[model samples]
Target chain A: MNQNKNALLLLTGISLFMAACGTSKTGLITIQEQGSFAVGGKVIASPGTFDPYKPTPAGQTFHGDHAYVFYQIPPKARKYPLVMWHGIGQFSKTWETTPDGREGYQNIFLRRGFGVYVLDQPRRGNAGRSTAAGTINPTPDEQQWFGTFRVGIWPNYFEGVQFARDTATLNQYFRSMVPNVGPIDIGVTTDAAAALFQKIGPGVLVTHSHSGGMGWLTAIKNQNVKGIVAYEPGSGFLFPEGEVPAPIEMAGGQMAAVGVPMSQFMQLTKIPIIIYYGDFIPEKPSDNPGTDGWRARMVMARLWRDAVNRHGGDVTVVHLPEVGLKGNTHFPFSDLNNLQVADLMSKFLKDKKLD
Target chain B: MNQNKNALLLLTGISLFMAACGTSKTGLITIQEQGSFAVGGKVIASPGTFDPYKPTPAGQTFHGDHAYVFYQIPPKARKYPLVMWHGIGQFSKTWETTPDGREGYQNIFLRRGFGVYVLDQPRRGNAGRSTAAGTINPTPDEQQWFGTFRVGIWPNYFEGVQFARDTATLNQYFRSMVPNVGPIDIGVTTDAAAALFQKIGPGVLVTHSHSGGMGWLTAIKNQNVKGIVAYEPGSGFLFPEGEVPAPIEMAGGQMAAVGVPMSQFMQLTKIPIIIYYGDFIPEKPSDNPGTDGWRARMVMARLWRDAVNRHGGDVTVVHLPEVGLKGNTHFPFSDLNNLQVADLMSKFLKDKKLD
Candidate 1:
């Protein structure tokens, strides 16, 4: 009887271990709710009697200039959800699975018990309808984007870049670039983003690349943006009306700061802000325009940070290489080291009491 | 000793049962491989010395007219994957999830151990860059689509329509409409689709609404298309030379069939084809153009079916309401009763030995 009891105990232990293994392999996530909605668009009605039958474009109405938001809330979620906005030539897919088939920030944050809401800003991605007219010329500019995105110089990988170097992976990365159906209007986009904040209530705003400037404008427009996490903000840096800095000249073009009222600029100082930059940016200007352009952006970023901090604002700029985290591209959140990056983000959220 | 053995068995059984329940709740799916790629785009080089710095569109090259495909394969996937193409004014999101947050065809089919590939055809959705120029006017057209999609007449729901009647659900449904970055060119889209088939190799093609015509054209272009499943094909029906039917006049516009050589038309007869139409299509012309337009399409569909059958092809057309599944809209696969619709599709797949 004693031997049998010992055997039973061992058997139970083994069975429990097997069950635990099964759970990890499946990686099952429990989602309490998930859905999507649109906000902040105007309806344009054509002048004339509308006819359902024999309808013509001249006598039709259109609903556009709206932002679309898709959300998934885990059960018993945290106090605030993370609202993710994409950069130029991208949509919500930037926050989804990466080109290499790895989990993106959307699932990463959700797995950590925080709700994730992704947006397709007006005139791009799912929000492809626009009020303004713009032409999309079929220009072979992937090489330019490839260099600009810091994945690497065209046809060559930067030493120790975080992106997958396989042809298939590159194919996906290039294919992900989309075009705007209409000309990009900063005012229109910010208005739509401000509306998104109003609809979602208080939440942390996450912005990338071209959307960095829009984040500040949106936060100023609405008080619901409790915090901000910006990744490689390339343009649209805002300064007080009289304190705007001189334009930084680059090989491709010039980067100039936008000016807003001191009252509006002060709103940014009310929130905790964090900005992250990736690897390969030279400390000084380089001969290559692709690498040198990022160098200028970094200089501008520090200036932006100083401006915000002078006003008693909470701002922290992290250069991944400076912190010993290396090989990251412009898209650090979706790179191979995304999980480690996510952990760093989580720590900041906890420290700021934003999570 | 006997009592101890019995207790051990009970404990093991309970633990195993608990593990199974956990698996169901988490809905853990094991993905073997997943990624995306682009196919069939041409490179247009501009004349001049290309300058990386001070880049101008006049001295740049552009790549457009490509189809983007995102794919995932499950462990031990079925023999042939399903390549899903969306309709006009939409993208790959049509297959990801419904507006009401239910599983769309992508996940539904993925769960059944089949590989799934969703596409963003050239100049639409993710493949937004276009070789042709077009204007995207901000026209208020949601009500037009609302009625045309058979969800219901504007501001009302068709009796027992298989759509969520809540405001939020309706908001998402309307917001899903997108505009084309360029004019819709059948030749360009079909060429890109043919390239996708060549890359994927030996798969079933699934087309919805505006893409229904493209599916037939794609199959004719590539022998890799093993079968086709079309949902409410609006236009681009092909008949043999000298056998084109007279254009069907509708209140909104006219529906015309294209003429192709007998040799190319015969290619469609080599594979099995199935078509599905939803509710609210009148048997005869009605005063309401929205409903009447579909009636004309249905008539064309039968004519197309008869033509194919005459050429010794196997084709099946299913009207949901006629078969006791009522109140379906244009998007039956993503409707509230999507699971039931999936099962119906599965039955057809198995019967035709295409599973």
Candidate 2:
């Protein structure tokens, strides 16, 4: 072809690549802090971008966004977009670092030709809560400690109705981006994972910790999620009937006390689900060791399995002793040992790779 | 007692409890980033009222000091302070958060009544490497790729000859404070661990990785340590005969080329020793699958065991498979599903506690 014609073709290819890449809206959303606050006393987001201002309307508050550090690798063949999420108070950077200081899981994925995106939660990562007079700073250590202990993030982000709405919005975003990058059929489990799968039609779902609740909500509400790998997902059934009480969520400006009906949640969904827990339980209320919670988790798994079998749908439920799939009681994704979790996750999603 | 004397005694009791409750330090070293530089960039340290900045000399640079966040529980007693050093590019904060977002092993110790101090290495955590004036900015892709793979601050902080000197200084400081804090037996292995143990009058020397080299050096040259726990310690014998490398020194000095002789180093100390290794083989060289390295470690272990046995001392070598410790790789400390190495470490330490 002539030089001018070749240049024209090049431009067309570039445009096609950009269009095929997908639509990703990168911006900052900040949530206002309640009560009196001080300067230098805010939680700034990691990677530093999104900011939420204060004076949030009574019911319309709690707006925020998270950024994913994206890296595209070689071997331009069809592949799955790998989405990894960080635990509470941690950024997506945790998954990428090894104890010995080697490249994180993202580097491994990128090197192996997988597109990697590390997800930050709305109030987590670089998205910080707004301070008095509209400034972004990381929530105070007091708030983080409470969040770590499960009292929930101060002015909890993604709780009650806002949680469901945020879930749907995030899912829509993931689905809309799938066409540009590749396919979402690879896997989804955490809030982003389930949302991505639910948005992109059908795929696997992997849930951990509080997000385990998200998995149940998605499986019950969205038909597109085909499987689940629930890692130490928090559900009422996991606790002794009267020992650990149910999580309290507020709806319509009143506290709505509800127990996690694990068996019912499982029965509501028809898909393969794997429930994983850590064996080395810490001395804590939630982490009650010796598989105290396993019985409940098992019951949920069994009920789901039986329902699928009755309907002639294929689903498998297996216990992962070698996998520290769920973290301790806090955030499952923060476990430094998640390399094995990722390995197992990779295996679970291998056959489902997108063309 | 008189009324005034009785009141004085009560006040004294209260003061004692408060003093024993928590302890603070002065002359604490503080580290901070000069500016944004590469993750593994060479770390520079200088002394300045423990301030974050104030340059002194080229060779005197080190990372800033770190505060140990500790909790004391009852029953087991929270007196012993286990000084911890994270691997490359990591801070103590990561260890504080478990996978599922609960407190991890360090916290496990706290629950069991143990005080732990996890220190950050220089040029890591809040202190990162700064760029030279007018350095070019990396491309967006390069930032994602290179930035994601920075080394842990510890490695960058204590390296070459500076590591040995720092270890010595830290040991003396701990020894001086041990009387006030309870017992300050230094426990480290691997390069930093070994280097630290060597500088102090060692109690039990636990060395991992390149720290094994330092252990041999301490054994042959310094006779301070009481016991030894070598976890997958690299072997000097693995090198070709007559090709052993020499001791790297500061002041731009070069000495004898042959490295420390393990055979000779073994002859100096009759300390009790225990060695541990993992089972999963590495799929790649850089993957750190210590499964293969175990055999090499075992060879070294056997030599030590035989030597100790002949000398009428005690030494034990336990392979993972024999103990049912499965799915563990080279990085046993951070293994998600299996913390076999750490479990064994605690068991060994428990014995020492009794001693």
Please report the candidate that would top lDDT against the real structure.
1
Against the hidden reference, what TM-scores do the models get?
0.85, 0.30
**Model 1: colliding residue pairs:** A54-B251, A61-B139, A61-B140, A62-B139, A62-B140, A63-B140, A139-B62, A140-B61, A140-B62, A140-B63
Docking class of 1: acceptable
TM-score of chain A of each: 0.93, 0.44
Across A62-124, the per-residue lDDT of candidate 1 in tens digits comes to 767788786777666899999999999988878877888787888788768788998888988
- A187, model 1: CA deviation in Å? 3.0
Please give the DockQ score of every candidate, comma-separated: 0.34, 0.01
- Model 1, residue A47: C-alpha shift (Å): 3.1
Tens digits of per-residue lDDT, candidate 2, B1-355, equal: 6999999999998765443332211111111100011111122333332211121232233211111111112223433444444432234433343322223444444333344434322222222111111111111121111111111121222121111224322221111100001111122122333333343334454455434444545455445556656655544422223544443222122222223344654443466666676554332322121123344345555655665565465667776657877644443454443234566777877775512
lDDT (10s digit) by residue, model 2, range A313-334:
4445545444424333232332
